[model samples]
Target: MSVLVRRAALTVVAVAATVLVAITPAQAEPEGGTKPLRDALRAASQGYQDARTAIANAKKREGELSEEILASQARVADLSAAVGRLAAAQYRGGSSAQLQALLSSGSPESFLDTAATVRYLSERDGAQVTALKAAQATLARQRKDLDAAILEQENQLKELRKRQDEALKALRSAGGGDPTLGFGDLPANATPAPRNPDGSFPSEGCSVKDPTTSGCLSPRTLHAYNETKKANFDHYVSCYRSAEDGGEHPRGKACDWSSAAKGFGGMAVGAEKDYGNKLAAWYIANADRLGVLYVIWFRQIWMPGTGWRSYFGSGDPSSEHTNHVHLSMR
Candidate 1:
């Protein structure tokens, strides 16, 4: 075949292969030795994140209510003082003073002016009283809401503790012996995922097309993947596997970033380990922004509430996650 014809044929074959991957059902789980461990990590991480969001929302509401209550209280105090002064003036003046003013008027026009002035003072005092009442009512309502917010914060704290305990339990069951000095912080930035008005992540589906694989990813996962590339950590990445593969991969809420430039390889060491460390630190630093559930790298895992714990999977690089950084999103 001519060179031009051969190039066209190869292009067609590549397109066909991509289509096949897109349509192919996920039949087997990836990484055979780590299914149970991945499952536990997902459960613990997700629960901790939910509790953390709730607590943050409750704290924000509490702060707002507090500010409003302070303003309301100040208004009420000022109104009360104004009303008190009006009452004192009325008591000191008494009816005698009004009658004397009317008697001293020299003409009908003068008497009419005195009467009008008396009515205006009474009406003004009444309005002040009304305003004071309204301010008090508003203050009461705000205090009640503040109380409820406090209660909500307390309840969410309890839930947070429960989730933390569950995470610790998961670590113990997974043979994670103790906390380790995990990857340290490195300066990295990621575009924040869109959130609900209350600062919670919006529920998403496997809708966006995964760039690395033909499978699909949630919009959040896709954003995280792109942001990682922007940070110049681009290596090999695969996201959106079959749900049958387990954990967030099938749900399109996770990605596996290989340390090797080409793909997954043997245990990452030296520069490769450094790469994984930086990547893991970047995810942790941007966890809240990206709604990260957990990050697993180099035999350690980081969750929302639980910082870092030893995580050893069945004896293999994939299971141990020594060769890649695993990121799971909320």
Candidate 2:
């Protein structure tokens, strides 16, 4: 072969190797064959996270209301004291004090002055009484609001428990025998995804372009992908695909991080297994901030409420997720 042609061939091979390390080849079916279980996991995970967020918000509101009630009570006490003083003055003086003062007045101007003073005192007492009533009413309303907030927190806790149970049951029904003490010594924190004003993740569509494939991914998924890369787990990843089986793939809210550099192969072992473990643990640690619904890796799955449950996939590497870590986003 010519020297130029040989160099060109070498360059093409290098490029091919790089591409293989960056993405998996397109396949007809999704890796795992647990569509029903995945769907159940998604629903349960989302509900559980929602319940948690609601409970947090309710607690914050309860604190605010409690503080307001305390302030209102103080105001009511001060006003009540002022009103009591006015009542005591009226009781001691009676109308006789005013009449005596009017009788002693030597001129019409002095009589007018006394009358004006009495009128001013009467109006001030009435205003103080009105303020006391208003303060009491405000305190009552604040107490009611605090009660409602407490009730909401209780309801959300119940819902969170319910969702946790559902997730556990779904896994068990699909042959999840017991929880696994998943990977340890997780990597450091990832950059958080954008959130709404209230600290909750905002709704996202399949908006951003997928870097691995000529498809699209939600902004949250892309953020996860970028963070994973930043964590030095830059293996082959595939995020978006049109699957008839119905999962986050079609919605651009999922990504599969291959354990092997060459692509999805046999079960990851040794260093590759360690790589997958660290990646999975990182996702779990940052699940709340990343808007992650669930993560499946090496025959185990992690959801929000449930820590890590056994996951039984079809009898293959892809189905078992033994060679990749699958992430589903909310």
Candidate 3:
């Protein structure tokens, strides 16, 4: 073989702070506006599309590799059989060499000619054996490529699931409604949880700037953050233009309370963990009354219908939401 097609072995956020994150319903809009959320939703939706494309590509490659593997196996079997036939012929001829030559040869020179033929056959067999070995090597490489492609397909599927999960979550949070149902921000019929007489949270003690637009947070997020402030917890809080906006922060519809002693990458534990648990519970307890979307803290996320569940992501402290409680408004 002039060219041996070689198969290369294919080797394949902490959250801190008093974060009060919110999940916006699909088809609903933040009181602030929809521009930022729309952009975020678009991005999330795009991610899902990309994942699907990647999975498709992976599967296609897997199929091609599988075909190539089959071809390689067939070639190897054929070459082995060819080599076997050559060896068998050589064995049979060598077994009857003298006797067969005497029966067919015209004279002693015929014996010499028969010996030469046998020698030529032996050389051909040796060459066939070499070719057979080469074919086997090629088969081994193709099988390796096939296995790698299979693994790649599996990874792509996993990625597709993750992206789809996140995209669905984002769509629901962005009030895009259910994309599958072609609805936008559908309204809920559930009676809202009550508020204080003054239309404030139960404590009615949190303070917020009046304007709800521009750089100001939406009403619900502001209320949640203010609740933290009103508690006199001596904690630090920020509501707008966070690095991880995804629409809520920059649009001023989200608030993240830094729950960690350190920032961003800090892992919350011990007292920090307790604080996050209590805060998350508080938000869940007040969700309906405050128009809260969702709450994320301590490596977990909780929304209205679903209870607490493990939130998997980049696995960093910030990604885990262990450093803060992120709260957003609808």
The per-model lDDT (C-alpha) reads 0.82, 0.84, 0.55
Candidate 1 weakest ten by summed lDDT: 23-32
Off by over 4 Å in 1: 1-40, 99-106, 243-245
Each model's TM-score, in the order given?
Answer: 0.83, 0.89, 0.38
Q: Write the per-residue lDDT of candidate 2 for residues 66-149, one digit (tens) a residue.
A: 889889989999999999888887789856787788789889999999989877877888999999999999999899999999
Superior candidate under lDDT, 1 versus 3? 1
Over 173-260, each residue of candidate 3 has an lDDT whose tens digit, in order, gives 6443332211112223223544544343342212345332235555555655666555543344556553442545655656665565
Q: What is the C-alpha RMSD of each candidate to the true structure, in Å?
A: 7.3, 5.3, 25.7
Considering only N, C-alpha and C atoms within 3 Å, which residue pairs clash in candidate 1?
A: none
For this target, which candidate reaches the highest TM-score against the unseen true structure?
A: 2
Clashes of each: 0, 0, 53
Query: How does candidate 2 fare on TM-score?
Result: 0.89
